[model samples]
Target: MPLPKESHYTLADVLSWEEPDRVELIDGAPVMMAPPSRAHQEILTELTRQLANYLEGKQCRVYPAPFAVRLFERPGDRPEDVRTLVEPDISVVCDRDKLDEVGCKGAPDLIIEILSPSSLRHDRLTKYNLYQRAGVREYWIVDPSARSIQSFVLESGHYTAKDLGTPGDVLKVHVLDGCFIDLSKVFPEAGV
Candidate 1:
């Protein structure tokens, strides 16, 4: 079920939600998220592990989902006033200052959202625009069914299609400097 259209929710409201279901806040409205499939979980786990390994001893840190990402449009916005909050499948934060006890307070350097049936539209369009506007340096849309990945790099405040690759190809992270992921490892043929 979708969140009510008449109601406007905030970051604080979403955090206070007692329901076990996961949700994201977009434009001050709560958007319910569907449970991920086994394939999705596998890809997420592999990507997280690979990224965590690459970022070890580095300034940047990676986090998996169920993590909060507060998207405040303006400076000095209080937590209660901030409206947008999302949990990308994987988030890489290069700025240590954004790290809080809860989660990231600002946009992450890189965000990877593994596409699921319910999230295709939200991740490709709504969250795409939101992340671009919020200044996310890189965004990745991983398609488990297709066994492919599409990466977008932020240029001049807009996300540009940087790379699209299948299982045999390798994808590089522009924001992570020299880090890259082997597509075969990310989308194993035997798994999905």
Candidate 2:
């Protein structure tokens, strides 16, 4: 189901709300998040595990949602005035300055989102444009049902290259050197 968007809200509004359902603010609109499916969780786990292992003892860190990411926030931006907030299924932040108690205050080095039926369009197009505009360096969209991944790497502030791969392939994280995710482990049941 597409998330309901009845009223406009800001970072301050989101921070103040105590609702149970997780949501993301897109240009001041709230997008309700649905729970992940078993397959989605499985892929997310393997991907997060791989990224975490590679990041251990390193400066960069990986976080799985519900980690808030204020992608467009800049210096002196007020919470009530600033609007965009996102929760990538996986977020990798190399800049420690952006880290805060509220979550990441700026665009993460890399972001990964595992697709669900209700969120397929939102993730593929809406979030895709948002992340690209926010200057997220690398973004990956994983289709759990399809057992495939579509990757976009930013070049010259635009996503210039696209990499599509299946469960048997290996994907290198451009933001993290010497780091890779084994696709087979991400969706072990794909080839069976």
Candidate 3:
């Protein structure tokens, strides 16, 4: 396994460095993401738009990537100390402190990652653990190719996942009271 470089660099240092592509830190290790394809961008935009409509004037804020969300080991720690930085396809954060000029730097109340063939493994396994450990109340893994959404709720320090079928299936998100999203409306292809 490749380990993190011993040379400690601040978040500013990392951002200022001429990056060929977008990258995130996972336990101090760098993880690069493929530039989103058109399908991916369209799906993500729809999801963000739906959530924003539902959450408008509400406490929660829905955001789309390339917005960075830093999940640091310690609150108020320096940027260099930040080990996990991700730009989920979509995310909803109700915590004001997590919001900053750059982006959020902690777990959002809810996180949604739209999976592609390139990101399937990392999203299912690696990020599954990371988000759970970060204490995100709810996590949604939307697989456009599969036409399905996997809902995971953090329970007792672990995640409990449920398979939400196509359009008819209303995904009940525990974190958002009365907030249920019909997959068909969210994904145009999933519509009957």
Candidate 4:
């Protein structure tokens, strides 16, 4: 389907509405996502724990899903011209000013989206373009079924992906300098 006209609901209108289980405004359309499966939630939790552990007391702050990060319209655009609004499975924010009671009001430093059977295309394609256009430094798509993590680093307005499948692979996020994740521990029961 084609995108809606940019005259859709404004952020204030969206915020004033009753919250849904998982509602996001993407390119002027409200995309309702189903609740993630047990496995998806498990992986997200584990990843959040690891990120928190690594970023503890550091300048960067990590957040779990249901945290909306809004991509505001440009200077000449209307308030209703929200480029995208998504709640990533996990996100990191190094900038303090963006943090708010509702959620991060701007692009996050890093976004981690765990793939589910129902959201494969959105996670890999729709969201991929959205984050890249918003200038997100890094984005990760973790596929539990494949037991793999695909890390994408935004370089000059595009994203370059790195596929880390096995436990032996050193999981490194380019934007998170010096941060290292041991894939072995991330997917300990990969063969199962």
Ranking by lDDT, best first? Answer: 2, 1, 4, 3
Candidate 2 residue 8 C-alpha distance from true site, Å:
1.1
lDDT of 1 by residue, 1-192 (tens): 334445888876655656636888787777888788988999999999999999999999999998889866455777779788898999999999898887898899999999988889999999899899999999999988888999999999999999998988989999988898999888777835
Clashes of 2: 0
Q: For residues 85-142, what per-residue lDDT tens digits would candidate 2 score against the true structure?
A: 8999999999999999989998999999999998989999999999999999999999
The most accurate candidate by lDDT is: 2
Candidate 3 ranges with C-alpha deviation above 4 Å: 1-10, 190-192
Model 1 alpha-carbon miss at residue 29, Å? 0.9
Residue range 56-90, candidate 4, lDDT tens digits: 98999999988988855444544456646788999
TM-score of each: 0.92, 0.93, 0.88, 0.86
Q: Please state every model's RMSD to the true fold in angstroms.
A: 2.1, 2.6, 3.4, 3.8
Q: lDDT tens string, model 3, 82-146?
A: 66677788889998878888788878889999898888998999998899998988999988877
By summed lDDT, the worst window of 10 consecutive residues in model 2 runs over 1-10
User: Each prediction's Cα lDDT score?
Assistant: 0.87, 0.87, 0.78, 0.79
Global local distance difference test of model 1: 0.87
Alpha carbon deviation, residue 140, candidate 1 (Å): 0.5
